[model samples]
Target: MGEVRLYMFQTGTLKCKYHDIYLNQGEGRDWEIPVPFYVVDHPRGLIVIDGGTPVECATDPHGHWGATADFFVPVLDEKDGCVAQMQAAGLDTSRVTHVVLSHLHLDHVGAVGRFPGARHVVQRTEMDYARSPDWFQVGAYIQSDINRAGVDWFFLEDSWGDFYDLLGDGTITLIRSPGHTVGHQSILVKTAHQNVLLAVDAADTLDHWEEKALPGALHSAVDAVRSVRKLRAVQENTGALVVAGHDPEQWAAMKRAPAYY
Candidate 1:
């Protein structure tokens, strides 16, 4: 039973339509969901999972995102950003050891370039798809962020299993639960007292996880559904408290950074 420390950050709040997250639900209404990123303080390394929207989006969402800004507008305070949040909480950014992106989505990969010294990790399939996404997915990847120069990356092409034990310590496990994107993944973080699952976009909210709604975005709907079930099994097996990607209610209840979990 190896354990580590987990710290969560609310980089900003994303404003989008209800349909943007769930399938055929909450149309015509606007939704404000939290954009959260995480940092794990482990004996082996300081790991980061899923950086939020680009910090530049705080000042100029339009200029930073271009036309895609029309669909997803993020509202963030000047102090909002993964790097800024860590600094504010008294954590050293230079100590960031490994940055693992859940996928190369606009929101998820925004901070990759900020951690040049850290080893960035992602699935090979995700990297490939992000390079030349279909028309539907083109707007999701901001090439400048994911394809940033001088950033060291380590791709995992695990063919035999879903779980990759990062650091070989069993404290942080990367789970391949794709569907929201072709290579989207989730994370399983074990702290001293609990197993916390960062179900990044695999199950965007409680609605998706409960099958009350499906994700509006998908590379494969079939795989999306399967991945939700797979996450459920992980939750059951580890007794993990599952934290969905951008659920407003869940985010509200969570203890933000400076309060480790």
Candidate 2:
């Protein structure tokens, strides 16, 4: 079996609904959420999870994100992108063989075009949901990110279990945990010492996961709870370290890119 080293990168940050919003109903505070993308140095090839906010979003946030841009306001810089971050970490962008997205939301797929050589993976149901999203969810789905030409896409349409082993080695697995989005998923990486669950939007913060609370942003509350529970079970069963998608606390404690897990 191949050992894996996972590195975390900060692509950007998002100012979004505060924790109180999900816990209560008052005019909640604003939370600054860190937007992270992970690079897995797998024995077979380099793999990246979730592209962060594009550099272009910094110049024209409204144009790229529309109305919701004000809600989860992105803080991006020119050098904040998948390729740029990888390059900064001393990795060759051209060597990225797989790019797996937990979902197709703008923030999660913004820099998808950066990895030209990688097969961009997503759930088929997510693509379909993005194409014909409900009125309320329209602001989160950007067509440009999904319809780019020349970008290779590998859709996970069918799987035997709750997850699909991307490389068939059990080293990396994509688990179906729909909640934040209809087809939202999470990544499970088996390292030498422990299992790491990249619970993307399935659980935005550790607080949400620990409390079994739903975030302000979600497609289905019922499904969202179910998804978080699944992740919790995985963590409990495997004694894995669960990584939240935008948890400031967790991000603060993490070792930045170049220093890996």
Candidate 3:
């Protein structure tokens, strides 16, 4: 199989509590962590894992994200947006064939509007949860960002069980890892050299993996624990390199776009 290259992009950074991310007990220092999105250059077509915060959030922070924007206060320049990052890496954003949304959280799916031509993949449960009036996390889901035109939205059924092979080629696999949100998922990319698990909020840091700790912000602690266990099992089975969602230290050390893994 031809290797599918994975490129990392930082759409922006937002300030959140360390305790909220890692389930750590403390006063919780403010964490300015990278909001990451990935591009998979597969042989079939380009796939974007998560969109990160859109440039709109930068321009009209309060307008797009409401009070949460003010609370987290995303630090982003216009150039730090997903489209700019893809262009910077010399990839055409319009050519992005498919967009796999891990969940509909503001931080993850903010750039969903940027790829209008792409078919967006999300779990059925997540779409339902996003559209609901329930205020679970407060400012977690923004309807305007998701309910829009030109989005060829595709939802995976609950019957898919634990995982759905996105391409059916072993290039990109979506693992059903819930708890952070109702239908949260993670991506596993198989390259020629190694398998990489984009544990995208499933485990926010190595600490979560090491300690098997549920995130402080969780929908169901039981499901969170099960998701973590799934990640561990995948790691043990395939020896995949784990990339956490909001790990400050890990983000600092990763090779950013213009470089690929």
Question: Which numbered prediction scores highest in TM-score against the true structure?
Answer: 1
Worst 10 residues of 2 by lDDT: 19-28
* lDDT comparing candidate 1 with the true structure: 0.87
Residues 2-33, candidate 3, lDDT per residue (tens digit)? 56789989987888776778675557677678
CA lDDT of each candidate? 0.87, 0.83, 0.84
Off by over 4 Å in 2: 1-3, 19-26, 158-160
How do the candidates rank by TM-score, highest first? 1, 3, 2
Error of 1 at 221 (Å): 1.2
Q: Indicate whether candidate 1 or candidate 3 has the larger lDDT.
A: 1
TM-score against native, each model: 0.96, 0.93, 0.95
Q: What is the lDDT of residue 243 in candidate 3?
A: 96
What lDDT does model 2 reach?
A: 0.83
Candidate number with the higher lDDT (2 or 3): 3
Per model, state how many residue pairs clash.
0, 0, 0
RMSD per model, one decimal: 1.5, 1.9, 1.5
Query: Which sections of candidate 1 miss by over 4 Å?
Result: 1-3, 158-160
